[model samples]
Target: MMHKPVVDENERRARQEAHLLVREFGAEAPLYAAMKAEKAIEQKDFGRCARWKRVLEILADEPPADLRRSAAAK
Candidate 1:
């Protein structure tokens, strides 16, 4: 008979959940845009950051009524 270590499924699930949360926040489209802007600032990439920041700003603006309505449907 071979002995094997048992893994706790609950712990694995918890780690997966935590990883998902981090990814959701980290790679979020809008958040990525914001982070890009910040990175550009650090690198003195004014033009690049300006473009990304503009994108972030535009995304932050109010969406059209229809879009907002549709997004709220869920």
Candidate 2:
């Protein structure tokens, strides 16, 4: 029997958010979002930084925006 891969809630959320952002912002969404997170970090806002970091975890593994657009087109 084959085992199903375990699903990660954070990863799932990141992908879904990636799709939404790509659609909304086109090519720049991922970088734009990352910049926002970076800004949060710079400002020492732990709460916002934590939220963005959580959503951005798998974003590096996944392509920034183009991959998201192609996958959503399917």
Candidate 3:
């Protein structure tokens, strides 16, 4: 019989912290939200993906001034 490997305490704590960050920040944490969104997409979970996309939309940063000005000039 194969024994289960032990979980490292620090790694566990870090995972917990990351989970908390996702819970607290949702889409405001773009990297975390994007990761979740990608996972959702991979899982074919459209609803979950849409939810994450909404959060991403809400928290998306404005374009830089130069980009905005160039677009305006077009």
Candidate 4:
């Protein structure tokens, strides 16, 4: 009989956290919004980029409690 290798607890937890991130932020609408904004920056759309940059700044500054918990759990 062949046996599958066991996953480490930390690795299992990481997978769970990754799933949550995807669930929370990987919806089509939100992903499209972020991508569109990022593309605007790439195209030298400074005005749009500045606006999107502020949005990103807000997201970056406010790390979710669940994310923090996951980091601390590691």
Candidate 5:
């Protein structure tokens, strides 16, 4: 019998928060996508990493106004 790994409650909550952010902030979606890509890389999940990388690239072409403002402020 194989047991499923238990997910930490905090990690689950964080994922839910990230999904909410994606739904609420269209422009900030890529930032979350990039973060997912980083996690995929850490897990050695190349396919998921590649998918998120593509999303990040596409979203990066036209950054959200908030991102632009933040970048300009830096």
Candidate 6:
């Protein structure tokens, strides 16, 4: 039997939160998160930077709006 990798609870929560943010704010959500990450880098707040970077990573994996629309229209 093949076993699926276990997801950490915090990581799962972050992904869910990122998706909700993207849905609520639309395409610019990732852009905003990236800007924050850049600001964090300037401030030398590596932890905050890491969190925002992770959010961008999660956002990158989300389906594009066009793909979602096409699938829905099918």
Q: Tell me which residue pairs clash in candidate 4.
A: none
Candidate with top TM-score is 6
lDDT string for model 5 (1-74, tens) is: 99998977644444444444445666668778878889999999997787677656545654556444543454
| Backbone N/Cα/C clashes per model | 0, 0, 0, 0, 0, 0
Clashes of 3: 0
Ranking by TM-score: 6, 2, 5, 3, 1, 4
What TM-score does structure 2 among the candidates reach? 0.54
Poorest 10 consecutive residues by lDDT, candidate 5: 13-22
Question: What tens-digit string does per-residue lDDT give for candidate 1 at 25-68?
Answer: 43354666677779999999897776676555544553334223
lDDT of candidate 6 over 1-74, digit per residue (tens)? 99998988757655655666666667877888888789999999997787788878877876547324443454
**Candidate 5 TM-score versus the reference:** 0.49
Error of 4 at 63 (Å): 2.2
| Per-residue lDDT of model 3, residues 1-74, tens digit only | 99988867644443343344445554346677678889999999987787666545534543234223443454
List candidate 4 stretches off by more than 4 Å: 1-34, 65-74
RMSD of each: 14.2, 3.6, 15.9, 12.3, 12.0, 5.0
Q: Model 3, stretches more than 4 Å misplaced?
A: 1-28, 61-74
- List the candidates' TM-scores in order: 0.44, 0.54, 0.45, 0.35, 0.49, 0.62
Question: After TM-score superposition, what is the CA distance of residue 13 in candidate 6 from its true location, in Å?
Answer: 5.1
lDDT of 1: 0.53
Error of 4 at 55 (Å): 0.9
List model 4 lDDT by residue over 7-63, tens digit each: 776455434444354446643323443675789878988766555554444344445
lDDT of 4 at 51: 52
Comparing 2 and 6 on lDDT, the stronger one? 6
Off by over 4 Å in 5: 1-23, 63-74
> What TM-score would candidate 4 get against the native?
0.35
